[model samples]
Target: MTNTILGNISFENLAREKAEYPRLHMLKPESFKHIEIKNFEKVEKEISFEIGYHRGRKRWCLDIYTHRGIRCDGEIKFFSSIPAIREFIRKEYQREPILPAFNQKSATSNFNI
Candidate 1:
């Protein structure tokens, strides 16, 4: 099934869970040597969110390091009436769209069909 196939993907497996709160791990700083991220930058805006439109009552924050791939992104939700941030984070992690896989074999084909 499509869900089974998708669940097998690495990114889906990396999705966080509510019980995984306070998730913290140190990444090798060298991985980010090529990308520059200044402090106080808003990285999640580059992604997507449904915050604010429902009301001025929702907020979320994300911290990211460009090199360790999607695993480096951290999310935090802010609101008194909603589910914990970890829940939303896990959902986002699983649903984040990814580029299609590349196929070198297909790239070499020149047939017009």
Candidate 2:
């Protein structure tokens, strides 16, 4: 069962698909305001990936925000151990270029003085 905010696609379903991770929404300082966790540390933070620990839950969780039809606000994938979380992230979150890098040379070539 899934809620309206988080769709029905589980982590397993996502692993099977060929889609890459989604683009991240620009996080503001207020983003952590709602996530009231005491001993939590943001272990990983990237443009589209984030991993944090919830001391109370004793679990490592990754954010479930994606542009690829997997939009979830508060939903997350939790892991039991640090190793498990690391390995899972390595396998699932393949560091692939979702968008082409900006080529400065090409852009500058077209500029007229």
Candidate 3:
């Protein structure tokens, strides 16, 4: 898979497209142009919430990849605003979504919210 874009998403383009979310603000401008990320996070097989962003013709929102069991069984859910992403991150990840160093140490941080 390519490294600059995750799936069909591109953070650099997203930022230029004014679609970047708070979690992504941690990255350097150059990082966005070359971001990549793991599709899923494994932690004791608990429910996982992978955040993503999208801007449609009439709306701009966040995407949440959710799974409680099999990773393949996960589903991508869309939220209408960034606050929703923040709330989910706090509840599921036990941290604020806007924290400065959100994914500084992760290999595939493109999908981090």
On TM-score, the leading prediction is 3
The lDDT for every candidate, in the order shown, is 0.29, 0.36, 0.39
Clashing pairs in 3: 37-108
Candidate 3: tens digits of C-alpha lDDT, residues 31-63: 111122357743443343344445342223443
Model 3 clash count equals 1
Q: Which ten residues in a row have the lowest lDDT in candidate 2?
A: 1-10
Please name the candidate that would achieve the greatest lDDT relative to the true structure: 3
The residue-by-residue lDDT of candidate 1 on 6-113, one tens digit each, is: 111211112444222121222221111232245966343233332211124323232333324344443434543223333554464544223223232232132110
RMSD in angstroms between candidate 2 and the native structure over all alpha carbons: 18.8
Candidate that beats the other on TM-score, 2 or 3, i.e. the better one: 3
Cα-based lDDT at residue 29, candidate 2: 13
lDDT of 2 by residue, 1-113 (tens): 11111121112113344423311221321121122234685333222445444545655556544332343334577776435544664466543322212233332232210
